[model samples]
Target: MTTVQLEHPHAQRRRTLVRGLPLAPAVVLMLVFLLGPILYCLYSAFTDMALTGSSETSFVGFENFRKIFTSDEFGRALGYTLFFTIVSAIIGQNVLGMFLALTMRAGGPVARAVVSAVVIGAWVLPEVVAGYLWLAFLGEDGPLNQILGFLHLPTQDWLFSLPILAVSLANIWRGTAFSMLVYSAALSEVPREIEEAATMDGAGTIRRLVSVTIPMVRRTIATNLMLITLQTLSVFGLIWTMTRGGPSGASTTLPLFAYQQAFQLSQLGYGTALALVLLALGGVFSLIYLRILRLEDGVR
Candidate 1:
């Protein structure tokens, strides 16, 4: 018989503390860097802080929130933010990515490699670079107009006339690869035998995809939606570089509007409040996605 010794609770705790010592530096750094700034921002949102003018900061309770809620600019920015997120991330990237993944799955290895390379090449570019690229592409005298002119079609100044759409399309082009990669990974995990069984049951491609593949990858879809929605909500550089949220704030999302308030107008407190609202919006989206995941788990 082998002799076994049980460890005391104090010994176990001591060993655990020793093991956790390695993470202490990381925890301290996060508190100072991440949590510290967040706390400061939370505090600042209620104050009358400014980027310029008086150095004194005074807390004004919910005045900032009330002003923001009543402001037309904020409402417009909020609407544009929702439009951008819904059109670009939720619909465009999600749909296009799944389509690309399905197409690649049905294609030869060489075709898949070529398509992935081309798509990911666009994705890998820095946001500023992508924005500039799209700006030039959609500029009044750019190649798109040139093509339209060549086809004898009327050409409009895309950036000036349809700034939001232009930015949304640019975002879709830039961000779709992430969704494609995520969906591709999810699709790979789905069993081939199940798909074959569905096929044997006389299910067409669309039916199998609708009835089988989508259900299997539903969790991944929700996760991707949450990530992209949050990302789209915070997009500033791309829109800034492309249109500067302009042609009269047509493409000004919350992030750009917040920047305008914080830096341009010197309203730091208002900007912090806007930032908090954006954070709350992201949190709402995360919670919804989490609920979906939980429901899926319950169903399983």
Candidate 2:
């Protein structure tokens, strides 16, 4: 015989406002710092802005984007960017990290600790430092060449002959630890009883991994792929320190190209347009991953 009382709509609104008051500063900061620059960049991408030689900035409509689409350099840079992202992040880091996680899961504690330490040491290195380290390692007179000489193996100048490959390998080495950590956590949450039941049903290791373990961790894998892809797409310091997108622009990705155009060539509008394109590329990747995740959820 108890009656439930309903609050008035105006009081409810006032209570909600009171609760939201504490978030005002953070909301204002985001509007000022985050939304502000994004809006400014959106505006700048359409203008004929430059660092010098142009006293007046004129609205260029799609002129800058047209220049980007028509430019050979932009095409080359876009191709390299895709190559780097796919090779280093999608395939290399993702596969190697999964392998390491599986190995550690099966190995003894000592082995797991040692491997984790080594992998995370590389991961924790600053991007510039890692780039320089790889640069020295791949240099002609570096230890890698010396080791090749000792083994009576051929060792050409790796950085010169395969600049993009070298950088991709460096990125893979530095980034794999993150994926490993992610998979390890996800794997730990997998039900041991389910795995044991699969074992009892005579499923081999590979079969169990493919059919059971992978399905369980698919969400994590997709999330990790999206994150690492975005991070790899934005990589600048590592590539800049290692190659400076040099040796005839063979390794030039969009970020390097944009920087070169904006600062060196003083084509700020074109560079901003390029930046927007890169952002759009990232958005596309994110959308694909999100779509996959939603589909997975629907299936579940």
Candidate 3:
């Protein structure tokens, strides 16, 4: 017979520490790189920090936040931001991508390959490159006006007249591929027999999609919306490259507003405060999505 010897408490504690040793570098990196800047920004948001105006910094304590809410520019920026996000990412990308995915799913092999190539090709291009491409396309004498001219239709400067719409459309064209790919993968996972059964039960294609396919993939839809919404909130390069949030602030979204305030106006404190508000907006949206998803899951 053999008796087991218990390890000492100190030895066990040392072994546990050894097991977690590999994670130390990553933890330290996160603390310095990620958490550090975030904490600094939060602290600065309550102060009177600037890039140039005054070297002295003081704790203003919500003065910056108060000024931002009372400012007309912030209100306009917030409105335009919501409008662009809804029109471009939420509506345009989601609808077009879903349609493309469904169409390709029902198409022949050749059609699928060609469609995938065309759609994904846009996504592969760098953001700035895509921005320039659309910039030219929407310019005063761009392809769109050229086509209108050829058709004997009057053409005006689209970008100058509607800067926000131009950038939103450009974003939609550039970013739709992500939604398409996601929906394509989700669509493939849907059971063929389930669709067939619905069809045999005298259901139309639309009915089957609404009732069966969509319900089955509701989780993917929620996740996709949440991701796209967050991405749209932070879209800066595309809008900046296209419109520069110009035509008299017609397209100045939160990111643009924040950049203009921080860098251009040299109000780093207020800018960081606005940036925090943007972060909070994202959090609110995430909470809404999570709550909706939870409710739906409970119902299911």
Residue-level lDDT tens digits of model 1 in 30-52: 99999998898899999999999
Q: TM-score of every model?
A: 0.96, 0.95, 0.93
Residue 208 in model 2: lDDT: 92
Cα lDDT listed for each candidate: 0.95, 0.94, 0.92
TM-score of 1: 0.96
What lDDT tens digits, residue by residue, belong to model 2 across residues 1-300? 746559899998898899899999999999999889778779989999998964999999999989999999999999999999999999999999999998888899999999999999999999999999999999999888999999999998887899999899999999999999999999999998998899999999999999998889999999999999999999999999999998899899999999999999998888889999999999999999999999988987
Off by over 4 Å in 3: 1-16
Weakest lDDT window of 10 consecutive positions for candidate 3 = 1-10
Q: What is the lDDT of residue 83 in candidate 1?
A: 94
- Runs of candidate 2 with Cα error greater than 4 angstroms are 1-5
- Model 2 residue 147 CA deviation (Å) reads 2.1
Q: Please list all clashing residue pairs in model 3, or write none if there are none.
A: none
Looking at model 3, residue 260 earns an lDDT score of: 97
For candidate 3, write residues 1-300 as lDDT tens digits.
645659898997898799899999999999999899789989999998999965799999999999999999999999998998899988999999999999997899999899889888988998889889998998889999999999999898888998888999988998899999999999999989999999999999999989998888888888899999999999999989888899899989999999999999999999999999999899998998898899997997
